[model samples]
Target: MDHGRPKPDLIIFDCDGVLVDSELLSCRCLSEVLAEFGLQLSVEQALELFLGRSTKAIEQYYRDLLGQALPDDFLARLRARVLETFAEALQPIPGAGAVLSKLQTPRCVASSSDLDRVSLSLDVTGLAPHFGDRLYTAQMVRHGKPAPDLFLHAAGRMQADPARTLVIEDSVSGVQAARAAGMMVWGFVGGAHYRARDGRAILSAAGADRVFAHMSDFWEA
Candidate 1:
């Protein structure tokens, strides 16, 4: 925590881009799968549209664009490919493990991804031990990012007041959700997926109280 900001009662982490560097891998896999279903998106476009969203969001996106429902099997296919790719190549964000190791604040994961994917991401990156069963997912809420429901849910479950929670996120929607939930948020831009864009400005515009590029700077003011 920074000296300028009140120490948080609890910290809520968004898994994909904040804890695990899986945004690029997941987005590329999503693009490949969507192409097979007659929807095309470059990896950059996929990241832009779905970086902090759920599979249900993806399905609805394609449904709106193509003007019909995606095949019932679409989410299943996407999840399988993403999990397989994750098991093979996912890694934690740079300095993520060290930060978690040193932090004394109570913390938990609340991600837009499913529990299965969030669990596997942590396990493969050697980050699972830090969270244990404190992981939360979009499946736990009726709505996902850009909606305040998920973050609010996590804060309640963790027994922290929403106003006293700190949300660390790497996407606009995540930052927005945290703000909507009345929590202070720091926008993280250290993931491989952010290397090509101005993530700091984007997240700041989305209402992040702080925007930082590396996990090593997590406590800096």
Candidate 2:
């Protein structure tokens, strides 16, 4: 542990943009699927509206925005599309492997994605070995990001105190959730989706304790 600064007893990670460069790809696919329902959005817009959110929450946002519920099979179709796309396109965040390999403290993944998506992402990116079975997902909790439930759940399961845990996230919702969980947060901006976005400002405004633009910084932090 780096004792020069406040070292956390546990380190929590968000999946999509933090561990994998899947945000842009996911947004692209989501935008395409949303168009089927007469809801049109560009990839960037989709990322802005739905990044770090669960599929359920994404559906709710669309429903709330359009004032109508999606078709019964809409999410099913969307999920299938996502799975296929991920199987072909998913990649890990640059330098993420090095950081994960070098980390000395306890670490785990807590993501808004379901277990299948998380597992597939890790497997596709060749990062599964680094995480093993230390995966947490929104499906495991009653609430998702922006609610603090998943992070708290992961910390509790890991036997780490909330106040002593650190979270690395790449989205506003994830940052808010970490803060709500009483954990220190670092906003990550190294994913492809963040290159044209001021993810630092967005996440910091949402209460992240620090902002880092690369996975290399994770090792230093």
TM-scores for all candidates: the values are: 0.97, 0.95
TM-score of 1: 0.97
Candidate 1 residue-wise lDDT, 114-194, digit = tens: 899999999999999899999888999999999999999999999999988999999999999999999999999999998
lDDT of 1 at 69: 85
lDDT of each: 0.92, 0.88
Which candidate's lDDT is highest? 1
170-219 per-residue lDDT for model 2 (tens digits): 98889999988888888999989877878778887999788888787776
The residue ranges of model 1 lying beyond 4 angstroms of the native Cα positions read: none
Say which candidate scores most in TM-score: 1
Residue pairs clashing in model 1 are none
| Model 2 CA deviation exceeding 4 Å by range | 1-5
